[model samples]
Target: MNTQPTHRPVALCALIFAFLITTAAADKPTNVVLILSDDQAWTDYGFMGHPDIKTPHLDQLARESAVFRRGYVPTALCRPSLVTLLTGHYASTHGVTGNDPSPKYAPRDSEVYNQRRAKLISYLDRFETVPEALGKLGYLSHQSGKLWEGSYQNCGFTHGMTRGFPEKGGRHGDDGLKIGREGMQPINEFLDLVKEEDKPFFIWYAPFLPHTPHNPPQRLMDKYSSPDRPITVAKYYAMCDWFDETCGQLLGMIDDKGMRDNTLVVYVTDNGWIQDPKKNGYAPRSKQTPYEGGIRTPIMYRLPGKIKPTERTELVSSIDIVPTILAAAGASIPRDLPGLNLMPNLTSGDPIERDTIYGESFAHDIADVDDPEASLLFRWAIQGNYKLLLTYDGEVNRYQSTHPRTEKRPQLFDLIADPTEQTNIAAEHPDIVKRLANKINAWYPVKKRKVLTTFQ
Candidate 1:
């Protein structure tokens, strides 16, 4: 008959609820959405000083995010650049060097310069991705649009609506053309599906727009098309605006589903904008070369409560994305991966731990070379504000130390002073040049063919 005793159980339950609320508030899962644009320029947005490109969504995202003022891609090409982004390793290390058709896809390895054999080896195989690692920690991993080369199915997506891009599929890889709403529609639908799911998700989206064959809806094209403005510029801006609208749509879904505050939204491009091939005197080597116009890209990371709106001049690379996402999700980053966690920067507005970053492009011009495409390699290291680029040609098995002809003397630039990389400071700072060169030379061979080919 002690009815008062029941009050003790109610009080205990209330105390437990308070404790759980405090814990949940202290440790919330950071939902991640990485939006990647193909061939988007670093300075093409309103925030980055484009005179006319309309990117309202990106500009808004920049205001709400930590915008990396000096974001560079490790590779200029999509397949290799993306490989570096996901795996946080260089193409040389990942072994997906050039977009050459591997032996399996080639008429003859010799005929195609033996680029096909390397295509058979995927860069994705070399390391565990952040999403995959997140999945290991009980997070839902979903991706729409471009994930990676031929094997989108095996790129470790829990639920993927990615259509096979040309990079995948062949006798060795799939060559099927992807026309018509490949990833966008599916992305919208996928967002609807996961709105009610109770688990955290990491959505890796790479939209195909503002790339080659610049096509936009007729209405979008008409919105920007005019008689007085530059035709190509108008078209490019139109494409970019349409892409930005798509971003708004995705973000709208998050807001509509009541997930904005809990989500960490990031937007980036695979590489710098491809200088218009149709426009003369725009920039030499639209892509496939390591230039500001080829490597620097737009990056926006908005982790609502975590990252404050600020411009971070500290240089960050695509390599940092892997560790950043893993750290945000409270997932484990594999010891072997070369990426550094960006939690400190995102949460506290601190600089990146890495002072220097490396970039590589293998066999970019191998088709013209007589020897094996695998024999050609390029290496670079950026330290402080200086960068050194080295090119290697000829046999991979016969690398020598003093091949002066093969090794172009290092070209160094003070990035802070000349963001355009127009000045070569290697001759002025001989000591710095020698130090960086030696470091690059020593670290260069670590990503040898043998190391790349070794599969776990």
Candidate 2:
């Protein structure tokens, strides 16, 4: 009908309404769900192209998220790496190296061991954690699985099941570590509470699956275990699948709640675990050693609407995760934190800036609780497809390292060319070694470059 006059006004009103809705949606508070896998191998995921592993959920997540294949953690050990993730500081910067001091403390000295463990737990009080930061802005946060930072309250989790207090036998997560292995009830309950409360939320789902106690469910074990397969390998493989299922349960909870679009899920392993070829144990190079397997992990950030899904080749670090989450949540990030805010890069689909990432292998116990540099067994730096590892002769609190250098020379690997790290081309390229060594020392200076154990 004769509607020319009405059409323009109606269109204008519709545009205004759409703009308001978009603006409101954009300004809505964001929630964060950080999935830190514990003691998992960098190569064990189907997404990472592992032949034996069947991590369908993680694979799907990788497809839908911005995946960085070259992601790394600063330390190979669990406690320190977890601390770094919490504080957005390296083990050295945070001054909490290794899991326990028993390796350094006197043998049979249970008294000293207990004391040192308590000291390490209390040490985290000095730094501001991610949860505490978000909680201040009224974000409800939950902690489950592998929480070494004292009690959940000690780490600023408003709600958590684990009691990490060392005195109460809460070393490295206690009952909290049972989250994934048992069920994701605590996490799902926390999610329910957050929804009911109508508040922004943060979740730390750092489960201890595929870690130790590699006792997978019977069906998972049946799939991997057989007379031909090594028992240890089968169990470990089964554990990986179990962990993947646990991850699916958690993600499914999010989807069931209809909060997937607004929630940001960040994934990274605390450190790599290489199952020993012969035994039910981890190999040196894979776990506590300064090798590709120790430091290498995939970093994924998924926010369906905000960040596009793309596989990124550029080197990214675990250090960047906290800053990225904070940015996504519209929270103010600490200026002094070293990690780059990867949100802009992920959203714009731009190449991540810069090269060098640092790592250290340290005593299972602190060499000196106050000195991170002294505690280090090895210091490494990665840049432009090259990785250099250096060992120093002495630090005041240094102890004998199980993964000591046998040859007193720098070990350099071209990670791009040799992903498995089968060959060390350090002799072939001394200049590259020198450059990377210099970078490592610049970040964490080496007092003496004697390469203590002549490790090759």
Who wins the lDDT comparison?
2
Model 1 sits at a Cα RMSD from the real structure of 6.9
Over 1-456, each residue of candidate 2 has an lDDT whose tens digit, in order, gives 875555778899999999999998788788999998888888899988898989999998999999998899988888888998898988877878887664545542377666676777887888788899898888999999888878999999999978876547677888888898888998888889989988899999999888989899999999997788889899999999999998999999999998898899999999899898698788767776678778889999999987999989899889888888888888899898999999899999988788888887787766556566556678888898888877655332332444656655777788888988888788888778777776766775555334522233
Model 2 clash pairs are: 405-455, 406-454, 406-455, 407-454, 407-455, 407-456, 408-454
TM-score of each: 0.81, 0.93
| Candidate-wise lDDT, in order | 0.66, 0.83
Superposed model 1: Cα runs more than 4 Å off: 1-19, 25-28, 102-105, 108-123, 163-183, 226-229, 277-282, 364-377, 394-407, 446-456
**Model 1, span 96-167: residue lDDT tens:** 655554333335536443344434344466578666777787777766555445444566767765444333
Q: After superposition, how far is residue 443 of candidate 1 from its true place, in Å?
A: 2.8
True lDDT of residue 403, candidate 1 = 23
